[model samples]
Target chain A: MTDYTPYVAAVYGLALLVYGGYTLRWHASYKKLERQLASQSQESP
Target chain B: MNILKKIQPLVGLASLIVLAVGLWYVYQAPADFQQGGAVRILYIHVPSAKMALASYIFLTVASVLYLWKRHEGADILAEAAASVGAAFTVVTLASGSIWGKPMWGTWWAWDARLTSMLVLLILYKGLMVLRHSLDDPVKGARATAILAIVGAVDLPIIHYSVVWWRTLHQPPSLAAGANADIHISGPLLPPLLILSAAFILMGLYMVTVKARQIEASRHLDALEAARLHHDD
Candidate 1:
């Protein structure tokens, strides 16, 4: 009908931002977890 | 190598490949006759919607396992899936609303599918609050598992909402039929498929990472508790 370019951009942009933000958070948390586990294991070892 | 070490590379690489290929397809796909450029929203909307449902299913199964066997890891997995599922649900609802405005002439309707999906998000948030509030892990795990199990009743309602009720939303084209197959048609299929795969890969990576975070948090919390106990 009308130009749906904005709607398309909004959806895709939102998707990219959400996925990217979450992935970064996941990576950071994973690194933190690894460090925690390492320190714990070292203490016990 | 440890499990995380092994999984990290595959997860990272797969997600990148999926994102690259999926976006390439999105760029190349043709416009729909009816919805025109707005149809692109389908790539994200449909996949995230389905993944939201898929995540809930995974959470339900994991919750059942936790309840049945009393395994802490199962509880961790269930909780992780719930968190990811909630995130996906927001994407689905947001994209759907944005797309619906021009297509359906309204941002939202109090339709069955939408309502049930909202309920699912609320349930997920409630579970997160429950997990954090309860000091007793054993009691909390059991309670949350039961809540997850009960919450699963919404899944079928969300899936069949269009068919079961008169709604603005269309019924699913989940399988092959004489007139239809996948919800997407023609050139849109390639990009949509690639994107769907990418979203699923990313979802797996998120869930696994979240599960590990929960476990690590638990360990750190335990250490904190023990240190405090010693000081006392």
Candidate 2:
């Protein structure tokens, strides 16, 4: 059988890149916002 | 919400672990008699497609709730799900195209199933743009919610496209009764199901994180507005 490993790898790799990239992006943004909120609350109170 | 925050990390970790297991199962499964190693693409393709559909459904429901109840959280949830759903749709289309190049001898076809899926991606993008395009947040939310509700008609069309017309796409392997034209064996089904579960967990984790971010940003906006009011 002809090797279709490259095609399979492309599919999996694309999925990882998209899902992993989004997760990291969201995590960083959320953490940054959370810190800002915490500091804002502390300053006000 | 606090409970969700506490469990979010656990859910993310579980999804990673489950995905690892699913990949292992896919590695163990033998190549197909006909398609050979190319068949392995189905593991990711099927699950991504399913998750894409599932996310859209979630978005539609959340959109409905937002429209009916006028809850900001539901609007946030709908927006979050739409973003996640868009990501899944991109993956689904990209992976399907990659899989198709070798199997179908072409990158894409203007078939019903494929066209509807593309429309889904377009709707997702449209929702995001509509929400941000307006200066008035309330107006934006209501307009996007209505658009989402209307776009949901595409879901059934996407689902039934295979059976309703002749197309390059095969009937759903997981479909039961007379609709099941493609029959995946018992051994092959497990990896697909496991990966699907993992995708669902991951998608849920992403949605929750996103919703929290949206909430926090809105809170900050309101606080800043109040501070300006105080100064004035």
Best by TM-score: 2
Query: Worst lDDT window (10 residues) for model 2 chain B?
Result: B172-181
Candidate 2 residue pairs in backbone clash: none
Top candidate when judged by lDDT against the true structure:
2
All candidates: DockQ:
0.70, 0.80
lDDT by residue for model 1 (B137-231), tens = 88888888888888787557655764355433444331111112134677778888898899899898888877777778788888878878979
- Candidate 2, residue B183: Cα displacement in angstroms equals 3.8
CAPRI classification of candidate 1: medium
> Model 2 Cα displacement at B136 (Å)?
1.4
Error in Å for residue B82 of model 2: 0.4
Q: Would you list the C-alpha lDDT of every candidate in the order shown?
A: 0.79, 0.82
Off by over 4 Å in 1: A40-45, B1-5, B157-183
User: In terms of TM-score, how similar is model 2 to the real structure?
Assistant: 0.89
lDDT of 1 at A23: 67
